[model samples]
Target: MAYFTNFKMMMLFTLFTLTSNAVFATEVPETNKSNKPIPEATKFVTQHKGTFNGKNLNYKVVAGETYLLDKNEQPTASIFSFDYLVGDEKNNRPVTFIWNGGPGSSSNWLHMGGYGPKRVVVPSDAAHPGTAPYELQEAPETILDITDMVFVDPVGTGYSRALGETESKAFWGLNEDASSIADFIAQWLTKENRWNAPIFLLGESYGTTRAAAVSKVLMDKHLINVNGIIFVSQALDYQGSSPYVDDNIVSYITYIPTMAATAWYHQKVDTSGSFEAFIDASRQFAVDELLPALFKGNTLSTAERARIVEGLQRYTGLSKQYIERVDLRINAFRFAKELLREDGIAIGLLDGRYKIDERDDVSADPKTDAAKVISPAYKAALMHYMRTDLNIQWQRKYLNPSDPALSSNWRWRTAPDGVSWEPKYVNTAPDLSYALRSNPQLKVMVASGYYDMVTPFFDAEYTLNRHGINAEKIDYYYYEGGHMMYVHEPARVSLLTDTRNFIKEQLAQNSEK
Candidate 1:
């Protein structure tokens, strides 16, 4: 089995991907291809450049070798970084360190999909749940304009390879991952000579968790502090976000509000009486009635519990029987398939808005398969466009939305007895009080999609509230989309505008001080 290596070219191509919509402001259709080439221009190309979606751009279309060094400088694991420098290098612009989740996922999706130089073209009616000749188009709003981005794929993902099993496992644990990514950031900055530039960590899904841990590690361990951190659909404190146990009912409580919002957007639920009124009412019910009722446990009378379940089913689109059996607590998986089970369809896990009635008909897992169905089309279009139009190519495997190794156990530093003790809940919230006590310049912004089911916006909001970030400075934005919100043109343009504004503000604030 390959450990982790050769990711430069693969990581470079992550110029677009999945999640929330309505935040992006770019509405142009395949208007341009990226102008940046994959690094190591000579690595995999016979031609100097090519076209991507009829747009002129740069590309490094071949695999450029990267070596991983250990203590005393021994080759540890082979790894790489996809370098897409935004702005003029002569000026030494700020840089954003970007990544995706899945303890094992490569940063490709986030790189390409959300803030990258290239983005996928989604129809206006993105929530319709259909497929298309999806393609990657030039993205003018790539966070690149303000910050040069280095997208990374950890060991075992993309083209990263370790020396052997022993060295490989070194990168497989939680602490290991933190150390590895922190080290990578240090090394990348040194190699790129951008140590003087502001550093920001941007992550999605598990990457959100990764960013949180990395933020701490970078501070305490690496001593390299970042200017700002962006948690896209941030996911931290797994116990609060995931439904792993019975009391996991808390996860459902946070998710209900988000589900209602998405349903309202698609007109799947009754919003005739005023959508805000409806969601506000639901939120109130959740905070007041549902959460209290669930907390009471068996204390509630049978009729009371029944009434709560009825409300939950009505709002969540789940069956009353199923809701009752699970005590009104259901995870994303159940909702992904069961919500529309009568329609005989399972929704796409990556993008909840996508749906497939029959797995056999699609030849892929309802959750995973739908990604495959749409990804190839988008990817193929991306490859061709980036190579031909952008004229950039570093021949390494492009990180797809799917990677098997992502399922590996990377959360580590477990005790000898197999008891892992990471401060499950930081007794003190990770807010300005915690992170900014030493550095008040640190302000946090959370970009979320209201329709997102994976890391529901409400859950993220709840988590942030727990962190003690000042409600005033803590900025939150919601797109009318799910996980990878920029898939739609409207969202993409709006998100870009928001990103640009945020970066400008950060820079202005830094300078003013």
Candidate 2:
């Protein structure tokens, strides 16, 4: 939801305590008894034709339990691969592996609302649209109409997790993550034997790095081969990524426009010019004028500071007095509460556009990705699907990650580290570089949300550019979305439209090849 924009820190914090503290469902051992080479997939033909929020929902995928086994032939982790029959399961069109970004998030958001068979309803709160109605209707907008979509959860996020006493390390690290996914792909392909089906990767947040890493693991491990990869709010690396430093001043720099956009919706920004024009000018000033001045480190004259304050006030829709009061360093929380605190209103961090006039505007944390305004319907729907639709009922906590009660802070940390590289051990940076060279035809698309503070657009861009993906060969589109673009209905439609067009191009190009 809107909270996903600043999900990086929150997700990491949540991950550390999710499994035990979080109240989501938990995975159990698969119900099938197969002591063979590759355990047979729990094949079942079913349809989810439910209706909610006055809309119809539908799906016709082979919903079943997919498994990956060690040499001893015991169940490791369980996954549900939603196979949409392009023609027949035999025709072999193309298979796209889809996942959510959080190292802790499940694929439900992307699977349900993005390009899956169902979507959660947006609530009425203008500041934060939630599933107040608790409706999970069918989403015909699913890309399954074209490409076969397989939603995956990294090892711990969704139903795809190890059982009690199972080695959790089998699912950790860059290489481990890729190989686990690669193993799943290979087993699925062999179980299904659609060897000719071209593979594409779609990952959001950390999953983007997962996709990049996995493409190589697949090649080296002789696993799945990927054609194109899509990164949604990706973070390839985090060095010099965020401008939101020094408490809140620098964060205010980037978080301001988001604030401005929210303010504009409330008719608060300087009404002197059109919204887009106002935004463009403000962005330019921030990047060109303000940034240089701040980097000066006190070399700036008093007159210059006044000018910067003037521009910040004009663009941020705050009282010039308040702008000066903070010494030009208003953090996002203060900005959210103080910006409209007089009206007894508190804006939602997920989508700054939504506000609630409830209570005193006091925040527990300056940077909060609280799902308070998030729709619970998708979470509920995924739970239901796991039981009724897909029929996996181990149930402890559905989407809980490693842990959450600990003090977890997501800092730049370090490059994925020397401790672990999953699936098959390979250096991440060098491996990605080599694989791209091995198949220069592979193109990457890094999807970023401008308002996403979690995996800032700048960092995602920086990481990919570091990989040296040619600008010409890569497609980068900035959406006015938070982590999950679908949080705003308009953005959802726009993203789907863009995604469909991109897929159509791939299809066209595939035909020529």
Candidate 3:
């Protein structure tokens, strides 16, 4: 699928597509004919037996597309999903719909690296996945015994695309994306005749954002309630997670603990005390001391400012002089570069433990994420699995990371174009709150990585601790890895264990009700 921003190219492509092949339209008028004669939804199914969580079972893998239709029953989009079904017990079995996050991302990351039956083997020690011929190992720890899984790829990703006169941008906005996925879920349930099954949502990164919004959409629009939601590296509130903006006061406070953890991992800070104790102290300092000092700004006393700077230095392992120069505010990306600057290395934002020697040592931030070294192996493994194991013979390219066109044309507004509205950080925490209130039985599990600078563990706490979200309904789990914490083997096992237990607990409660 492709989108042409240039008028001449769009005209040329339109002519070419009309005569030769069809083009996937993005932001095109309803009158556009480029996407005419949409092809049939694709499908490939296979069966296998696998052991998960000590239970051996036979399962069917349905690698297929589910087309979503409009109000008039016209095909609007084709969402590709990989469904792993253990048995035909639809009424009793729980179904967990999963996806990874980039506003434009496919489900490949979580599919090939985290919860799928097979995963690409990368170093668990935070080292780069060196080369190809990477091992694809069985991930028997995934919670297949307790629940079925569906990994979905939204429009313009994987083999999914806009159909007929529908513009790809129709599914690219925050609300649009969530609504489409909700529609897909409804369609999926009806198609599989599994509408009565208990449903769960598991999402990572922006997928977490989507999950919250999707939950609200499901309850309000579809009149369907999800049993639980699992947020892997929760990013519900962007204010806390975004460390790029200079004046984001919440971010300065939210990232302190993650920075402390990173400092401890790199041996940049004192390791004399217990790590957990130190993290707790860092959190305290952030809220109690640092938050006040940053808020006071020019009114802060010199002595108090000095004291806060000392605390920042102690927690972040940056020098007092450097902390003062930055006015006590440290951007996460800058910290990644400055932490090991003397060693001519830059750490990753996704996983602070991963480091790389960059050619440009003077840059303010890393040229690229050090943790992304495992991506190629993941993509390769998924492709191989699809072809060999699932018997998939599709020619369409799978947008693993995400499609460039989707990213470029993504809409972030909650309102339609031309609507008068003030812009704010993208947040779906309120939507989550609404869902929880509407569905009193609903619960959430937040899984965080100590070293994830992108969506700091502390940020998750800050975001979820308020906005009328009940504290007791949420369960928190911490890991020793980074953004994609499952990349670390121990974290992977622990995460699976936690997720499995969470699902089982939810089911137990469902039975009681």
Candidate 4:
């Protein structure tokens, strides 16, 4: 009986070995989904004449789909972009790739309300722009004459989407997003034969974070080094900007100047001098006094604490009682609500200049942001423009801000291995640092809105000043508007001029090199 059992065991072992070897040898043909032939990219080109920067220019607008391929060279997604080209295609005109941030936003904000040739007309003074018969007008302040612009909508935003068997969630993470955008950029350059053109990246809000990471990816993966980067409402570091969390000492320090500016704006603070001087004083107070007091925690002396409280009240316009109750660490959200609470209004986070009358005046945070009031106008303008002017006919629904599902599922992981990811504060300043170091000639222009409480201008200074960045290569531009500074006409023109000059200067510098 033992001999028979031994024979059966040997036979079974041999059978298992043969089956495993056969399975391994079959060479599963790289999954049919990944090996399938990809469809050709869809491109629609139209010509139009427009006057920008006092130049009567004839340009070609290319509204198209660029397919992002998987490792097997199979199409995985269709990324949409609106490319505006001026001058002869033969000449190497500098190209700027622009996108808005939300991690979920479409490029429509920048396209319809910003540097695009046509802009959606909203009230320029940060008023509550009522439901529109939204007027669209020629944006003569556009940078088209100096550089060709391509407004990109990342996968799952606008008309861009995951194709074939690929899931939309695959491109929703930090590292994955940067990699995909970098791939799209490389593909765009290759397809358009614009590899010789000086490439510039312009990103707003969270898009700034993407820009920093993608710059590194472009250099490391494709050996494509960008000439310059423009950060609109820069938010590379969250630790400095997030003011709601407890024990966030950096937030207390960074938000002081912005609060002072807001208070000055609302006349909550008595300031007779220049706004610059007032802001400078607030900065000085934050660094010299507020920062130290916050760091002292529970060990702070009565006199020192009292002095810091007085400084907070003087800068933020909050009463001494409120400051004392909050232990001198005033939350930005609460400040936004409480600053105007007596008047039954709440200030906007995006643009402190805008005010909202919340249903609950006693709420801890503002119910809504006034900057979002103009979103409807932007959405309407972009859809109408795309269909009428660009003549883009698509079955897919155009997502204005983004697909809700994508935003909900967005992975905030900053690192691939997930070991060093900060769940609370997403900081890509180090990525920008690496990129700056990798390409020393790479210039960066930071555009900030004085009234933008979301990504405070002071935070931008804090993030950029560190990381050993070359100060000479960095340029700072400020505007009197909110996060989308271009919404204001004067700011729009000024930012365009600054951008055009920056690009020109960088190109000239690169040529000399």
Q: Pick the candidate with the highest TM-score.
A: 3
The per-prediction tally of clashing pairs is 76, 33, 0, 0
Task: Flag regions of model 1 displaced more than 4 Å.
Answer: 1-68, 86-90, 127-134, 164-166, 318-322, 359-372, 381-406, 412-434
Clashes of 3: 0
**Clashes by residue pair, model 3:** none
Highest lDDT against the true fold, candidate: 3
Encode model 1's per-residue lDDT on 119-177: one tens digit a residue. Answer: 66655445442455565565755655466677777877766756432346668765577
Candidate 3 local lDDT, 134-171, one digit each (tens): 89888889989899999999898788888887889888
RMSD of 1: 9.7
* Higher-scoring candidate on TM-score, 2 or 4: 4
Model 2 TM-score (2 dp):
0.77
**Candidate 3: C-alpha lDDT:** 0.84
RMSD to true structure for each model, in Å:
9.7, 7.2, 6.9, 13.8
Residue by residue across 1-513, what tens digits does model 2's lDDT show?
Answer: 211223334522331000111122222233324532333334445544533224443535565556666665566776655565545557777888887655556776787667776676764333444444466665655566556777776566654556434555556555566778888888777766777887888887667767777888888887455677777766555332333345423444555555565566666776767877766676677667777776774788899888988888777678888877766765555565666666766654544555566554565223433334554666666666556555444534655333232113222222465755343212244455666778756767766554444555554544556665566556776676666666666777667666666666766776787
TM-score of 3: 0.93
The Cα RMSD in angstroms, rounded to one decimal, for candidate 3 relative to the true structure is 6.9
Angstrom error of the Cα, residue 382, model 1: value is 4.7
TM-score order, best first, reads: 3, 4, 1, 2
Q: Under the 3 Å rule for N, CA and C atoms, how many clashes does model 1 have?
A: 76
TM-score of 1: 0.78
